[model samples]
Target: MSKVSAFLRKKPLIASLMILLLVLTAGCSGSNNASQNTGKNQVVKGGTFVYGRPAPVTSFDEYSEITSNNAFAIDKVFEPLVAFNKDGKIGNWLAKSHSISKDGLTYTFVLRDGLKFSNGTDVTAKDAAFSIQQHLIDKGPLAISAQVASIKAKDNKTLVITLKEPYTPFLSELANFSNGILPNNFGGVSEKQFFKKPIGTGPFVVQKWDPAGDLTFVKNKYYWQKGKPYIDKLVYKLIEDDSQAINQLKAGEVNAIESLPLENANELKQNAGTGVLTSGSWSIEQLFFNTLDKHFSDVHVRRALALAIDRPALTKALTFGYAEPANSLLPPAILYNTNKTIKALNFDTNAAKKELAKSAYPHGFSTNLLIASGNSTTAHLAQILQQAGKTIGININIESIELASFRDRFFAYNFSTMINGGQADYPDADSILAFQTDPKGFSKSYWTHYTNNNVTKLLYEGQKTPDGPARAKIYANLQQILADEVPYIPLYYPDVLIGVRSSVKGLVVLPNGSVRFDSVQITK
Candidate 1:
């Protein structure tokens, strides 16, 4: 059984209590809406909104060190220094204004005066600097602070950051939740148990969290925003099954869904009067091969495998024709990506056979493809690849396991090949850089155990330089290297398909690919 299932089984009574609370809360929220008053098509102030998420958050307090779906979910309750605006521009949130030095190695931020955390503690420059320090010590995802020479508080109002090298993506890192400013003097839990209770400087406060089912958040009375967060509370339900999630939306049990399956996208689009469907580019879903594996270690075998698949057909079959065939690691329209020189993977069965003959396995060879359980999308892609491989006399053995187990397996290099979904948490080439080499002074996610020194040198150069043109040239060259190596075959860029209730308005679809719930208002 999965870790989550085992946890629920351990605390059956708590699970039962949460179920009872859910029933009562749902009943109250539903009935309370009838008598509550809100603007005609504008936001309401009293009602609570129920939302459906694919999986429950594993940790709420383990900020800066871990990345998960719940990271975004919890961020709603905790604010960030900068946010991706509707037009994909980085806008000021906690930091009222900011300025960069002429050399591009220093940044000075003017905090929004009179800001306070949900705990009523005043937010200061020390809070912002300390948060960044915390991430560097833990070697978190936003660990750019090591290169950061110093972060000094000019006063209670101004915070300055000085980097050893020019780093343009520092702004993008600040936009992440890890850099979110919390009260500097706050201390309560051990490092390991910190996630049990998380305090933030956002509009909502976590009132209750039932690990097995849902987490509840109530509006902070002292929120910094002016007349915002129309809803009184937010509830996130853990509904792994798509059918159950869709049923809950149709039944008005949940106002919004985390994601809508591509098969249901058209149906939801047709019902515009009651709800709407929105989509945008997510990260690249690619086929990654273990470079260290004996069979795939051969470049000829890797090239043959890449040439064998019919990517167009696979894209159509897996995404229901709602995705674009990927040509590079970074999304096409994402900021700072200029890899237009790269070309898509062309299907060449005859060429594939020629390359296969050149390899030791002239007839064919079998390998296992690892897939995440409960994710039918990855399973479908695996099946398509299996069929395509058979045409070239290559046999594929597909294996499926839940995300938790899959995480351990993928990290341990337990599989020869795998299909995985990578989300660009922030919009930049640096987001895709995680999957590349183990660059010095950087966090590594090169799970395929692939590395190239030339690519590594370019990545480091691009990271330290602040010039856009120079960085673009380096990234393009890096992508070209990957294309030639075929370490990970670019599959397709999947759409962030979503279903929204018609009663909800002001819910702008962000360019970075996440739901903007703060602006969302119920109009029923």
Candidate 2:
């Protein structure tokens, strides 16, 4: 078989069936507005910009949210104090301007005049402070809350945030989903009831939501940005299948679709009335090992696994020329990612076998890889690992778990091994380094129960130092250490490809997997 064909090929029968289904029902189930799309340059107001989002939303509580996709939906209804622009630089969003104290421990923000929530009540420093406090109470993104000492609403427009120490990522962390401003105390409703119908100072208001169906949002007339959100309504229609979503894009049933399958990206980019927004996203598709397990406890075994797969070849075969193999824990797009600077553990079958012989499980050991089902790319990865594991005398069992349960198990650190991926919340190296490398991080340092004094020290060193050559040196050393230890194997860095209609304008597909929708307008 040819190289590309071999890697892309899977269970032929199932793959054939899925392809058949895509062909048979491509545009048949599109929304009522399904029709031929025609491109135009003029911006038209009062039109609905329907977005095709995969999977129904199960949660909208930003304070305790787990995944970026969940945050994507909630973000539409809640604007941040500040947000990263296309360049990953922090820019003022809700806060008109801000300044930091000389010691860098305190920050003062002045709210934009006439700011109001979806309910028309004015947005004040109190609301922002209350939102930050709520995030801390809910234990959202520990790195963020752990640094914040206190938040004070000095006046309706001025807010002061004091940190226990000078945390460099504090501003970027505030712009993340976990710190989005909401109504003070959830608008006087129970926590459960409030998130059920959340209100925020965002571009759109939640009109209705169905966990198993579509989520509709109407233009928030009270939205801080004047004459903005030109679309009369924004709808996140649940279309789980990539082919079907692409079909809807062509048929003009959906203005945009998230997570466009890489296989079809080139085709969609070439197709008329359709354009694909793709970038070298700041993320990685990788395997997380549970070092507590006897089989994985040995560094030799972990390194063996890393050397077995040809990351470059796999990425090339899978991404359709859209991305490069991840040479470091951070993707190449991230600043100071160390992709080219530090060489990765390249494919070495003989070296892998030698490393396995050094481990106690030289005769081989069996382990189960728990992965969430429904993702074809992940399933394919499991198969490749299963095959590679055999060469090293390891017996691999692939466990396909449902998405929701998989998350529950992962966060609890209840697994032998798992395949997972995510984009950094912010653009900086510290954004991911703090959470994925710090021992007390969100993922418990890549969910392996892995810990290292050197990594821990470098993580904090990188966080405390401001971004520059000095800070970059700290992260480079950190990456080198993690690479040698092989706590989590660096894998492919796939580009985030979003399917957009030709007429869709002002939509920003951020490399961090969150799109900016406030300025998104459908030009008809």
Candidate 3:
């Protein structure tokens, strides 16, 4: 079956019809509109929006954030030059207007007048230029920065950037959390000092932050957007348990639950008025391997694990029929992503055993699966993998570590196997696809150290190639190459779920699973 046909088969009859209707009227948000109160008087703002956070957030260094929890929290206190709206359209945030040269080599942006950081510091073009340059300096972590040749502040109000080549994803790259603009030269302070208590041209200012507990944010009086961030304060309380999160949502304790699992969607929707909001995203939950590890060094072992996973069954177990099994590294929703039936090494325990038998460890070996602590979803994923590995005589040990240590270990390439998931910084495929497959890509910057020459060439080709069928063909080829190589086992591309109180209005969750709070209002 094709991607769409398979997707419909996985969902309920009602949901399948809804999906067909969605395809007919494509741009409609697949959210609970009646509960969100779209037509309600959203202008009545002034309540504190207490959002429940599912994991620990220790860092505020926007450009170096390791976890989505940290990124989502800090996003309120930092502003990006440009961002993708819910509709996948790029919109100006800090820039009033922008223009690209005819050759597409040079780009100029005019800063919005009267822009100021949370601390009331003037947000100048120099600050914007410095921020972009700083991100570029951290070259390995930022794939998009490689496209830039030079960044200069033409004037206090004008910022110009010269690109090494004509790249399509530059604007979307700016939307990445790690690319948020920082104060000029770290506000005349050391990088550590500035990040300790960061200030930016966002709608909120960090008031108090407890990495293991909760975070409080006050409305930014100096925010460039006038009379915005409807809520006066935002308290992000850390809740690790899924049950507790749902209880809190229903008890009227918190207005939002970040990263709510789909299994609890119905309970929340039935009990709490309009408690769930879901958006299609490019996010993929996958299991990665350290290619150099003793057990995974052999290609046969890696490919064995890929075929061992029952993706259809795993998707149902993980999302409770809320998500479709991911057919490729990129979700079918993304541009240039193909839904054609692939010759994937799908679930076949017998084939998996045969491949494992060919490896150096013919009898299977023991390895630890690293996941962030307090994430029930990943914990469950670990359990499922543990059982599945057992079927093939592999002993899977799960190690749940805190966010801080997880980051350290991940970047250090210390683990044998790990459960990881993420979407592109923006909607474009290269924002993540190349970052994970190409040698100059994922292995260089991310956890997966897998490399292929063909993947790298295709990635570079896809970047310079303009938006058309030609680019799509290049990306499609790249996907096939990665699938065959098995750098990672793509589990499923999940829908971004948020359990929200019906009273919360004007909240915007982007397709990449990030939320915008500038317009969020809490109603009683």
Candidate 4:
């Protein structure tokens, strides 16, 4: 076994041991029911909440380049300039108001005074400017936002941002926790130190992180919100296995978990009193054919491969009908042209054989299917593809590697065919395009290595325009181009499932396709 795989294998046992100790010390039930029952109707005071999370965090530094789980965890401890309102519109959070210049080059931000960091430092425009510049300094993962040309502090309560160009999606970018404002005294830290010891300005303070077990957060007494964050402490336990996570929730060891398996949903629903469940949009699995590869270089071969596999069957078997079969490159639920000509290629084994015969090899050639290791869903999907490919005389050898290894290999164009799953970074269609089309020509980052001149132009135009209607049209055209290019074959869009405790209330879904835990409160 590889080092990562070995570590992952050992991690669960360690977590279990830690959990056992917590159970022994804290008692079987996590509830302080005596206090809770008496004060149930009164102002929310405090109670420690232990919860289960589905994935392993790649990093804890809110500003560092890391995985999605890293950002999700950071959101709990960081404050952003603006937050998504109920209508999914960007509303003021740290900034009281903001305006873009007529030319769209400069953005002026009016700050809310008297806001203090967790350390009691007054949040000022200089702090905002420094936080923005930190991204450009290669100090942390926040370096992704180096696209900003200048961030100037107009005054103590006012800030002005000058962009390299008219970035239409800048607001959506700001919504990312990586852009969350840090205290002025917060020096840019190394990537290693950043994750190990993270400090942020948010509603909670990290009390402890037992690396092998749980991360505990106490409610920030100095939180900006008035008489809020009713819960005393939030405890996040790292339970790697779905079965174990569900078991903990049922046993009342943990309060909630994300991405619950659909197969177990019915069983959990049967015990509705103990487990409360909800679903939202989060992730999609896709088949990425390396266009740089000689075999997939042909459009007909790509189309034929698309036709051979049965997405409906795969979805039913893997996702228990909880996911929508996605044939189009653009997700069906996206705000773009819903009636666009993008449609699923039908499952036809005969057609696939005919297409293969027309190619240089009358018999289909063998290829390796690379997948994220230790992921059951990807393995299941690969098995389905292998069975379907056999019928079409296309032999597929499946290879499962750890995510970190697979990402490095795939980005280097070392893998040809892979079952790649992409989670939507933002609710926007532009986020989808960043993965497929490569106008820069065979990018190591773009696994598809897809090059389309027309699509590239449309993407540029879309990024430049601030008008929503015009932007939609641009994305609509790009989606059609994507359908024609076929860099990625869509598989399924899985509905995000979350299991929460009965007493937990106000657990609303964030627009970024994650749960807003800050808004959650555990009632008596």
Candidate 5:
């Protein structure tokens, strides 16, 4: 057995700590009554909410596609076993109650009585088991089926899942949108047919869909949550242009839009008729170095590049003081943060030059910096890096490509350096750490091709250790090592800027960029 497994076996207190961490990270539930009024505002429902999305949704099937745009639309139709409430607590949705075994390897879930899908079919434990099996067969980008050793449906209402090993973040992972349950016997449905018409047990049902246009939804009359989903109709209008969306919001063509540019959001905030919401986002804009590239193979070269750019200035210029400079992959507010201050790589041209001299290329070299076109913020960030590189005697050529092409090339490891955004599927630190650092994980090629046996061991140990001072110490050491290794340069954690019409009430934007419309009401 590994040292972590041995430690877990010896320490009885670790199990309690694990439960507490799960609760802290998963978020708490609200009232059982979904339609309970806030008491602060009289919810005047029965209105059509025109929501503007920045991009067209690629697929309605969460199991097949992973995109924020798709999630915004799917959240209305599909209900996960557990969901994060507005307060960011894990709450029972499809499952009425759940329990974890003392050994941390078994999970039992009881389905809510009278649960039914949009088509009036019962949502049983067998359906949940089918969903897990489908995830395993499909092997989607966010699939977690490998974690399960076996899943058994005890009855129509009971499900028991046995894990291959102890996974601290299992509950939180189940709360992800990708794990949303599908109906039983859905294996025969083709991917194309499922994307065209997907069924779920959520508050709304798909009414109509127009490709590259607006997708409309109507309240599910038979929705399990009684008197909820106050809005009569919800429409997601695809507007690819940011400026055009802002103009629509100003002109009262749209009720709400998320992820607005910082500058535009600031301007909307100044308008009396506009309501702007800004909160620390789970997303981070970062620069990932291709460690396999000869130019960045040397640790000194990567360190020099990390030290050359100014993160604070970039945050201010790009997010207009709405974001905080990132010191580690896990945000300080997250439950896993150690609070130990690690020395950050500050911008210093002289220091960067000195570090570069230690590399094979004493006189620095040239490389291309890849970025997605049509993103003004990333474009400006690339320009700043270009200027910083000149000061350190390195020539950086900025290359902007279509978003689709950029994603393809990035995952294929075709770039020397790439500026992009990444977020954990769940609130746990293991989500990000495992994806970015686990050498045997699914995202190994997509991330910086960094391989360190010691770091890998530390990461695995951190996952097994319960949330406490010991776990904190493990993560602290990991962060310090990553900071020195410089596989990725942490930039800033951007704020989720959202603009809403002043009359739209009870709309809450979560830190993870999910907009809650359960209690939303429109007042003309």
Candidate 6:
């Protein structure tokens, strides 16, 4: 699972109980019209908005660490040529306009005139081309760099990108926050110096950073967007404990917070001074099997375990009815997930037993299930699997460890099976699928270490095909193949929940789970 998911999954019951109390208090106060009240307020500037994050940002550099925890902060300092709006549609941001060739292999972008970085340096087409080439050289967390054959600056205002093949979701891939443009001389800077003093063409500039504590930003005077970033200052307070963050929100110490405990989210919806914003994200929590493990080597054993879990019940229990059961790795919000006919592996213990009987160990086998410690939801999931395993004659041993230890074992390919969370960097299926199935270029991010020739071929073909019925068919077949193979069992997709003070207007939670504060204003 992604670090954000793990952070949010902690202290669910306590958060729920706290929310119940807050809801009762809100009921006795007055009518609930936080949304209407917010709309009635006028946009005012010159206030510091304090936001809360459950964890500290691992790195300031976008290419070094692109986790959701740091995305909102990074976006304030850097911008992609194209970006996803609040509605999840791709729109021009730094670029004035863009076009794709008829062959679908070449993409051209025209830079807006007089763009300047936070450091007062000119941002030209050369910076765009250099940023992409730097990502390719560094082989960052994102997989989009793998498809680029070449990137060249036609002139000061024009940039061209040539792909190895026709990639239909190329535009969406560029919209990813990880693909944010950097300064031309960024490659020559040392990592430590860059983190301490980062430069970008974004709305805000880093004023102060307290390790493992908080990050403060001041408005960028050279920001290209005129009169934007109405808020003069943005503060991200790092509080690893969810309960403390919720308390801070209630006390008005913070203006906004995300990944609230489900129960707290429920109660905050009725609170007059608070507004709860919920939106679907591309994040998916799933069980990934290590194909290198002996027990999971057999398809029958893998399929049996997949069929044994009741996804609908698990989803309801974990999310408190706020999230829907995920049938595939790609959520329905993405463009490639157009196929609705493919059936998910249903819950059937009898069928599970029968499938296990076909495996080498007809009597079933024992294996360790790795999960992160401090996550109540994952602990509950592990217990559910343990009980269900007994019915199918399979034995499961749950091993819960700290997040650091879990990552160590997971990326080293030392686990049998693990329940984790992952989010597509963009809306494209290739963003996630390529890393999972690409045998030749799989990074440490692909913890499952799954390798299948057929799956790899399908992923490659899907990337080469343009967007249409043919491309949809390729992805449809690919999902079916992975479903049958049982490399990663789809669990559920959680809703992105944000709690904001009613006075905070125009705060939008993007589908990718990043907060857009360009139009946000704090009303008195």
lDDT by residue (tens digit), candidate 5, 1-524? 00000000000001121111110111011222123355884546577878887656556777655557676676677878877654446767899999989988999999999998888888899999988777777776666733689999999999999988887777877877778887876635876686578788887788888866788888887788777688888788987677888888887888888668776767887776676766654566778788889988899988898889888888888888777788786555456553248877778878899999999987989999988676567778899989988888889999998755776786688999988766655556665666667767655723578888888888888777766788878878887888888788888777667788777777776655667777677765
Off by over 4 Å in 4: 1-30, 33-44, 85-87, 139-147, 188-195, 210-213, 337-340, 358-362, 373-376, 401-414, 438-446
* RMSD for each of the candidates: 7.6, 7.6, 6.7, 7.3, 7.3, 6.1
lDDT comparison, 1 vs 6, better candidate: 6
Query: What is the per-residue lDDT of model 2 for residues 1-524, given as tens digits with 9 covering 90 to 100?
Result: 00001110000000001010010001112223222234664444666778897666667887666565466777788877888765566778899999999889999999999999888898999999998888777885433633788899999999999989887777877776667898888889988898999988888888888978898889899988887776677888988666788888898888888777778887877787788776556667777788888888899999998988888877877777877788787777677778888866789999999888898877888999988775566777888888888888888999997666776787688888888774576545666666666677555765687899988998888778876789889988989988888888877877767788877767776656667777665554
Candidate 2, overall lDDT?
A: 0.73
Write candidate 3's Cα lDDT for 426-500 as tens digits.
Answer: 657776676676666424524567878888888888878877789878988888877787888888877767888
Write the residue-wise lDDT of candidate 1 on 13-104 in tens digits: 00001000000001212324332345564344557777787667666653543344556555666677776554445678888999889888
How many Å off is the CA of 345 in candidate 5? 2.0
TM-score of 4: 0.84
Full-model lDDT for every candidate: 0.64, 0.73, 0.71, 0.63, 0.71, 0.72
Worst 10 residues of 5 by lDDT: 1-10
**C-alpha displacement of 50 in model 3, angstroms?**
0.9
Better of 1 and 2 by TM-score: 2
| lDDT for each residue of candidate 4 in 182-284, tens digit (9 for 90 to 100) | 7664646654665576666677887887755678888776677765566778887887677788788777777777656666666665664354444434345
What is the RMSD of candidate 3? 6.7
For candidate 2, list the clashing residue pairs, or say none: none
- Candidate 4 local distance difference test against the native: 0.63
**C-alpha positional error of residue 201 in candidate 1 after TM-score superposition, expressed in Å:** 1.3
Report the lDDT tens digits of candidate 6 across residue range 345-408: 7899888989999999889878899987654567788888788777888899999987657766
Each prediction's TM-score versus the true structure: 0.88, 0.88, 0.87, 0.84, 0.89, 0.88
Question: What is the alpha-carbon lDDT for the whole of candidate 3?
Answer: 0.71
Better of 2 and 3 by lDDT: 2
After superposing candidate 3 on the true structure, give the runs of residues whose Cα lies further than 4 Å from its correct spot.
1-42, 401-404, 440-445
